[model samples]
Target: MNLKIQKISILLFLFSGLSVFSQIKEEQLILDKKREPEVKKIEKKKTSVESIKNYPPEEKSQNPVEYSITNVPALSDFQTSTLQADDISPNLKTDYYSNYVRFGMGNYGKILGDANVSYTLENKLEVGADAHINANHGLQNIYAWDSRQTSLKAGAFLNGYGEKGKYNVTADFGQENYNYYGIYALNPASDVDINQKVNAFRVKGSYDHFSNEYLNNITFKSSFLSDRFGAKENKGALDFNFSKHDLELPLNDVKMNADLGLGLETQSTDFEILNTNSSSYFLGNLSPKVTFIKDKSYLTIGSGFTYLSTNESNLSLDRKANKTYWFPKAELQLAKSDELKFYAGVDGGLSLNSYASMLEKNLYIVSDQRVTPTETKYNVYLGIRGDVDELIKYDVSIGHSKVNDILFYQTNNLFDTSIAAIRNAYDFANTFSAIYDNGTKNEVNASLQYFPRENFNVSGSFHYINYKMENFDNIYNVPTFSAELGAEYTLLNKKLLLGFKGFMASTMVTNLYDVTNTGLSTNYTTTEQLNTKFGGYVDFNLSAEYKIHKNFSIFAIGNNLIGGNYSTLQGYQVLGAQILGGLKVSF
Candidate 1:
């Protein structure tokens, strides 16, 4: 019993000690909790002090903040989606035809035929042939004069492309036949059975080499031409050119280019009149040119050195001449834009006047005629060309040129006049001769083109020329003013096309004389002079075509629709109003 009581007392004492320690710990926790609020308060005060110290002075305003909204837009109806499709269609493409045939017949027993064909071989060769024939019986006004013209031409060409160069070779042959039937107005009773024939052949070959280094490119060409009339001519030429494009220059923003050309030509002509007379010409030309280009301006300084030698069986003393000519070429594009362009230039050259070429211009030229080259000293021109709108375009130019040995057409006055009746017949042959005159020419030309609609087009041109001859008072058969107008319209989805054209020329002078002396002479002492005038006439034509198929069509043409009697040349009166209908086939 005593031991149990002693243990109880010890346990009670231990429990009381434990209770005192817990009370002390609770007191310490309460003190910490009270200090925590004070510490947090101090920290908040410190943060506020720091923010006030760093704040901007201007932002520390004492007034109360206010906010308001004014002038607000009123809401209205709004569309969510709006879209549309294009209404315009694309343009139509044209179909090309390579071969065609046409045939027609008109009043005054006129007949016309034309045909052309072409073939391609192996993608490298092309061959083509064409033929045309036109004939007309004598008009009522001009009796016993029947005229006809026929031409046939055929050609073949080969093209070859290589890595560094390209080459082309071509061969062509042509034949032409025509009648000189303009003699009836001068002598109605004379027999009118004269014909002229021409046969021509040509072969040409050329090669071009390309390079990017010093020598930019080189070109070589060779050609031969032969024409056989009662008079025959044959010519051969060889040409070579060395060129450097875009060569570097010493000046800034300036580029340079150079070209050097060498040429050799030989020609021989045989004239068959009363006796055969022959002439041979040898010509050589060397030309060197340099061009400087700066911005929109270009200047070319060049010179051509030519040597010509003629061996005429008749005239030997004055058959050779050597000439050196300097040409100054310059162009300034004063203003260039989408609507307008202004430019000026000067150009000059020496041109060959061959027998064949002269005869082509004036078919009535006498067979035994002298021919010489023409020299154009210089020509200065100023031009302005531009588009007025999407559908209209215009070009105007004025130029002046000085030429030496310019050829003109004159009537032959040297026919035999022994018999009075027969002499009158031979005197009125209405043949022409070529004469040369040194002259100065001033010209003004203007052209306008308009496309008012997709299927209609109209164009017109005007030309004015003033010619002054050094030796003669008047130049014969040369008009001073000329104009041409043309219009075309298509309808019914391009199935029908209508066209009209008109031409007008001012008066031209011609000299009529009594041939009393033999041997061609323009001397006033030997012939009685009579001055005549021609031209100052207008001509109109209308045509229409209806396409029955894509490759076939029918056409009708009305020529000289005004039915006015007019003469283009001195003694050749044109046919009156006539209508022609034809069929066209294309492949």
Candidate 2:
């Protein structure tokens, strides 16, 4: 039989139906992630089985079986990756000097000057100093009283690039002087001069770890403020943060992290809320957060527990200012691509307020203004941001807020028969008062930036807000709608730059009190209230700069070209048009 079938090859065709299964265990991926942040991702592909196709039966098979079948096996999942960036280098400009000095002068006896100096030692340490001054003489013919102001600011800083962290320390000082001249029908010849002179000092320090984020940073700040009106303040704050990354959860396979922050603040002031009472405050907060990141999304949840203790001389109008607050800090981010993102969050906290801080906002406020902390119960917001072709970027957001004890600048209600009869500097509607109110606020915000070319760019921002207060009819000095637009064009090899800026705001609300003399001159009283509205104004500005040398440039700025008499507060008018020319020297 072997000799006969040697040449003829008999192929045995056996047909059978069978099914096979295999259990495949997925391999968990471990990524060594460092905090060079920001992410966008998508999920991986799943394993799949290919369906078997039908085949024609063998017509001349001698050993036929029951049936014919095919088997399909799944393919194992795999991923592909590109080269990773593991090294970095310094990208410093060789022909650039960051230190400069500028000086300018304009009409109305205006003067402006600023100087900055910096030095780097051995590529490890840096020291810098800066100073700024702006002053203007009195504008007498335009206003009934003198309108004059002088401001000076100076600062110095030290920085060190340590092996494991970075260190920064800074000290700053400021001096400001201005007159309360926002009065109506006042005689300039009368020697009724009330001045507001303030002096401030601050010291700040920070330390940030480079690689070890567990002890991420520590920051501390202290400030001292005093004024010629016999008010003084001393305040300090300290905070630190720690973080743990790539935490392995109990039973979940996701990227996670934990972060914790602790802060402390204390303030004691002789700033009189009334004429005789002082204020003191202390606050401490502990915050903790956990973050979980999956394929193309991230979620963070946290809370801030704050203990606040305050004593405003226990005024008769209020019992005490002591409370504990809990604020939610939660957010989620979903990314469709590297350039597009959607985010939503709910967060709130406590805002510490002081007389010196109030002066920073409204320089014409009363010296004995009432100051207290603000409590934000919650802020819920949603936003979307994206970039197109690396040339344009846009973001829009909408939010709602619940707030307590918010501050507003309103005109003081005081009466005087003559300038000499004014008892306080803020009398005669010359200065503002620190008014507090509770309310719910809803707002919308949008911004856009376009960088179509290296030499030309444009930017715009818009905001809309509405407040429903509980006790007050209106929120003083707050605009409901605002918008700002700016554009810059650089030609002549980036040496000749032209800039344009414009800002617009909607109507603002304020109130005036009607006064009626009583039976005697001693008891001055009135209860009737009056609501006033000031129409909004629009303003536009332009600037141009030309470089004569690499280290020198001359610039001119034209402000309020629209000349619409823009005023933020009542009875105060800005200059119609102004032009200031300045020179800069870099070395």
Best candidate, TM-score: 2
1-587, model 1: which lDDT tens digit per residue?
75676456445533543343232110000000010011110111111122211222222232332311111111111100000000011011124655677777777676666565655555434455555555555454554644444444555655554444446676666655555555622444435455566677777777655342233333333333333336777777778777776777989978987888788877777776633456777778787888887765567777777777767664333355555556545555554453677878877777667766765456556565666677788889998876655577778899999999888777665365343433322245466766789999899999887777776667788999988989867787777887776666666666766665566678877665553433354332236344467657666555667788877888777665555555555555555666777787777
Q: What is the C-alpha lDDT of each candidate?
A: 0.57, 0.65
Across 1-587, the per-residue lDDT of candidate 2 in tens digits comes to: 65344213111100000011011111111111111121112211121111111122231122333322222211101110000001110011114665677787876566767676767677657787877776666556677556777767788988776655667898989887777766643334435676778899989999876543488779999999988777889999999898876677674567887899999999877754345447789999999999998756789999999999987763453435778999999999998674788999999999888977787567777777666889899999999887776677788899999999978877776645433364555565567778888999999999887876765667778999998899887788888887776666655555666666566677788765654555566545644344577646555555666777888888776655544554566666555555667787777
User: Which residue runs of candidate 1 sit more than 4 Å off their true CA positions?
Assistant: 1-96, 145-172, 184-192, 204-229, 238-242, 246-257, 274-278, 292-297, 313-318, 420-427, 515-526
Alpha carbon lDDT at 305, candidate 1: 70
What are the C-alpha RMSDs, in order, of all predicted structures?
A: 37.9, 23.0
Lowest summed-lDDT stretch of 10 residues in model 1?
A: 26-35
Deviation (Å) of 305 in candidate 1: 3.4
CA deviation > 4 Å runs, candidate 2: 1-94, 185-190, 248-253, 272-274, 314-321, 415-424, 513-529
RMSD of 2: 23.0
Error of 2 at 104 (Å): 0.7
Model 2 reaches what TM-score against the true structure? 0.79
